[model samples]
Target: MTKPITILVVEDEMIIGAKISLLLTKLGYEVTGIVPKGEEAILYIQQNAPDIVLLDIHLRGQMDGIDTAREILKEGHKTVLIYLTANTDEETFNRAKQTRPFAFLSKPIQPQELQRTIELTVERILVQREVNLQEDKPLPQETNEELMLLQDRIFVSSKNKLVKIFINDILYLVAERSYCQIFTKDQQFILSVPLKSVEHKLQTAQFLRVHRSYLVNIKAIDEISQNYVFINKKAIPMVETAKEELFKRLNKV
Candidate 1:
């Protein structure tokens, strides 16, 4: 059986903390514990590492939520952190930004917003686990420049290092005779794999195979003609079947 996702709430106010814990329980997450101060949160996390930490920016003690998150992240813990803050000031925002929280939730949180954030966090965690497993494997020479897809981005093997590229940055992908070429706004990368092989792997909602030789980002489409789709001023041939599919996917209004 799959274990429920564990959560730790770190809020100074007792009423708010209790409410959050109750809501998490109702949402099917395991509420590990609720702590008032950053110091207590650190201690709890050290003893029982939860899958996610819902940290408030303002706390009861000297160490605020941001400081606690920083310490947890600095220690290389696998726990995902989400900041719960009513303080949206620039200074506080910059400090929290340094901690690299998975997502930020404003105070007086709605149930739908909280649920959505948790769902996205779970997706990211699952994707990270898959990427880590792929990274542990030995690289084959024939597939030197391989790409690992994640929830929001992809990791590409480049010069013996993994380079992170967000899906939003990608413009399109072109199928060469033997390899697949990935084009972003700044540079292009060639993966040592056939187009068919990549099509199965790039099975995301955003990417579409407009033709046998091209996979285009739906958001990157600049213009559409009868026979082609323009992306970054490059025309990619659109087959009759794919063109029909693309039009169906587009919003009517």
Candidate 2:
């Protein structure tokens, strides 16, 4: 059996903290602790590490969520940090970006969004662990049945399990050193595969290799301008040959 995903909730509001803890339990996660202060949350983290942390940006005591997150992330563990806040100020958002938290959620959180975020975050963490440890081995054709490709979907390795994802959801893929950053409409994933390997697995004409380091979903393109095409607000440039192929595929009317 798989071990439960452990989480720590740090929200100053007692009622909200309790509610989050209850929701985590209902979602089959183990709640390590529900802290009310940034300093207290740090204490719990140092004493007993959890798999994930739901930290409130505005908290009691000297340290705010961003400060605590910086300290926690500096330790460099696989633990994922997600911010829970109602604050939407540019200064606070800019400060939070420096800590590189996995996700930022607003106050009065919806259960569905929370659950989805947790699930995807856990998957990313698990994959990162595998990458760090070099535990993923290439299996033979017959044995590598876990990852499957269908007409409209594909199953990719997420930790020890295979998770199915829709093809249409993929907006773009960017090379991250030896890994690939798979961007979807609302989420992103890191895959321990080369850019060329990803292209092979995709097996779809719509996913065009625009740049040597970027593969984009043609359907997701908002506009094509000169040497670049925009997808999800990102400008992806194409090589000479790729540019021609892209236009050929479009066959613009």
Candidate 3:
């Protein structure tokens, strides 16, 4: 039999925290602890480690959620950090990405969303482990530029740290004022890059720039109508100019 996934909930809101904890248990995960602040959460992890951690961005006490996540990652624990927050602004999302959490869920999370996220995160962890086993040799040091290709499964470097991301696990990429919001099948990742810049890095056939503000992976697209394209469960608009190009790209894909 497989061992159950263990999760720690670090949230300030008691009532909502309890609700999420209950949902996690219902989804067949073990709730290690539900902490009400950042400092306590850190201490709990140091004492007893869990498989994953459900963290809230608006944490209480001296440290915020981001700080706690950074410290935890610094400790080199493989626990995947799933950030629970309502913020989606460019600055906030980029700051959250620096920690390189495994997943991100928006506020007012539905039960289905929460459960699917847990499943996907666990699968991602397994994939990473498999990839790690393939090559015993360590990655070389000192590289200036990176050429990453996001496919069914992918691994990329962020801040000199190697992070594996499953592309089929992604939903869409929303271009913010100066950053990009990478939404996955059950999560989101915000990166520091312009839409045009990231656009050039991708193979034009797989990723489509549906809107001036959105660049979506064609394979992850579920539906496309006259005006909008569906990425995972979210609807993103498609302007007239990009419509023909989008179809051509989709066909080529």
Candidate with the larger lDDT of 2 and 3:
2
Question: lDDT of each model, Cα atoms only?
Answer: 0.79, 0.79, 0.73
Clashes of each: 0, 0, 4
Consecutive 10-residue window with the lowest summed lDDT within model 2: 138-147
Best of the candidates, TM-score: 2
lDDT over C-alpha atoms for residue 197 of model 1: 70
- What's the TM-score of every candidate structure? 0.59, 0.61, 0.57
lDDT by residue for model 1 (128-244), tens: 454454457765553565468897888876556677889889888777555666789898766666767767777876778987767899989999986678887665667799988
What would the per-residue lDDT of candidate 3 be over residues 111-227, giving only the tens digit for each residue?
966876787677555544433443354544422234366555554554466566776565666664445556666655445455576677665466777777678887887888866
Q: What RMSD does model 1 have?
A: 12.7
Distance from true position, residue 134, model 2, in Å?
Answer: 3.2
How much RMSD separates candidate 3 from the native structure? 10.0
Alpha carbon lDDT of residue 210, candidate 2? 85
Error of 1 at 33 (Å): 1.2
lDDT of 3: 0.73
Stretches of candidate 3 exceeding 4 Å from the true structure:
131-248, 251-253
Superposition error at 79 for model 1 (Å): 1.4
lDDT of 2: 0.79
